[model samples]
Target: MIRLATVIDTFEADFLAQYRDQLTPDHYRALAAMKHCRTQASPMMQVKCTACEHQKLVPHSCGHRHCPHCQHHESQQWLERQLKKQVPAEYFLLTFTLPAEFRTLAWAHQNVVYDLLMSCSWETVRTFSQNDKPLQGTPGATAVLHTNTRRLDYHPHVHLVMPAAVVDGKQKQWRTKPRGKAKGGYLFNHKALAKVFRAKILAAIETAGLTLPARYPQEWVVDCKSVGSGESALIYLGRYLYRGVIQENDIVACANGQVSFRYRNAKTTRRERRTVSGAQFLWLVLQHVLPKGFRRARNFGFLHPNCKHVIALLHVLLKCVPGQTLAWVKQRAPILCTCCGAVMAIVRTRIPSPFTGQLPISIAAEGNP
Candidate 1:
């Protein structure tokens, strides 16, 4: 199978040439990470399984979260840490969206808009949760930011895993509510949130006095969802961040120095076509993928910022403890014992993903044409 990294690396130059006119610092950083993944290495060990005698040198993975291949181990480690943070209270899946009018602006200023989206969403949740009618305590939540729609369009949004209830300060009570029970919770009362988000963004724009187009809308587009809790939501969120916001399946092809991709209508799921020059295609891909150090998925509230402490306190108070967590995450077959179906016990160590084969150029061909 052709790794996505291979495709990205081979076409990176083509992408840069196309996006040269629109390149930014973030784009450069993302390209650099993809192109130079090997430099940042993790500790890998080699050993033969005592039970199965499966001999192999296990290659270490680069721990960079942006690389899909590298995230499996890290994701498992994170989930382990989060187990301690699971509370008995219900959880709410909250989403915040921006209107179509801000599309152009968000594209031009990704760093700014992305930052604003997270900050504003947190503000809205905090405000509502702390209101006298709501949970009232400092309701903790984890917010993950996604920059694309199902079809991989640059439609930035934030997904928040909010506790169905929260505890504020030293108060001795825990508030629990069903997801979607809050008035305008799923809708998030976009009319009011739009005003708050718009005001926050407008203030920034005014402070910066950004150049605006002639036709800008007064209203903002926002959406919220309160998906119920289950294994489905966690699994869904995990895979949601897996592939590129824009998947290769949607990419038509690169020909005639141009590239075409498909997108689906949000409301209708109808396929829509978009074509760009080869360079433009490269630009779009590079622009949409996150920079190396920038994390698209973030944990907040009780799930982050010392999840151990907050969760420990919550557990002690709530008289709860999560089930046993997993040991080291399960790696793929290449590293596992074929006979025993278990991680090959570590014996020795090596640098980089273990070099399983010789370089293609190093192998001499029998004859030359």
Candidate 2:
């Protein structure tokens, strides 16, 4: 089977061959890291119930959240973590996107564009939540940056998870609010927020001395929707981050000196086959190389400042209040061992580095005969 890592490897080389001399030191390192290694691994089991036997092995997965090959375990773990932080009230997933006309500019000014997206979105959400009459205080939120569409194009966007209830600093109360179809729940005003988001981004870019298409200064695209609940929100946004850019079904062929993949037009369902010369393919792969210490996921607002402890404190405080319940509990699902039908105990858990022959070491629970 043709692996996504191989394709990415080819692309990394192509990138260096073409732009090695042009990239800065940091960019060079990022490109090299992307080109060489980016896979993570977890233990998996194949169980044969009838035979009362099981096979345990360390499965290597493309650790790239953007790669489809490694999403299941990664996303599941992330969801489990999010579930523990769930509040009793409604949750909303808000997405902020940039216009396609800026794709080339984004590619050219990755650092500038990416920084603006994060800052602008964060400020926009924070300001809007506080200004909304229903949510009079700063509505706590967590936002993440997403730069690629389903087809791996340069579709930069931001995803935010916001609470329906905002803490009322003045009265020390929890103020609940909703907008549009999400009445009585955590909702965002898309049209209004979009307008403000556009304004904020343009202003920020201009203040930073960056120029945009002259005719499109007033036109920036932003999309917002209220995806409900923390679980649903995780599942929805997780899909975009994990298994996002590359698809297993989209693999056309891998042979000779080239590997081909398919992508669909964002505006149309029609499929298109795009083949990169082996060198060119490697260059594309290098584009995804993230700088070391660059976190793909982060928690902000109420969830920030060491999320678990902060949320635990909030949960306790909420229980003491009039409307909140103390029965809220966080539960984790059990992982069963396929081998011998025994409950598998995790002896160790490791996230492997992308370099080859690297594996995560974990031991299973065993019972005495």
Q: Which lDDT values do the candidates have, in the order given?
A: 0.60, 0.60
Which parts of model 2 are misplaced by more than 4 Å?
Answer: 8-77, 178-186, 239-244, 247-252, 256-258, 262-280, 306-310, 317-369
> Which candidate comes out best when scored by TM-score?
1
Worst 10 residues of 2 by lDDT: 360-369
Candidate 1: tens digits of C-alpha lDDT, residues 168-230 = 657767776544656434424557766776667667665655655557678775555554442
Number of backbone collisions per candidate: 4, 5
Error of 1 at 114 (Å): 2.1
> lDDT per residue, candidate 2, 279-364, as tens digits?
66544544554444555566665566455665676678766231222122223344455555565444433434343442111101
Against the true structure, candidate 1 reaches a TM-score of: 0.71
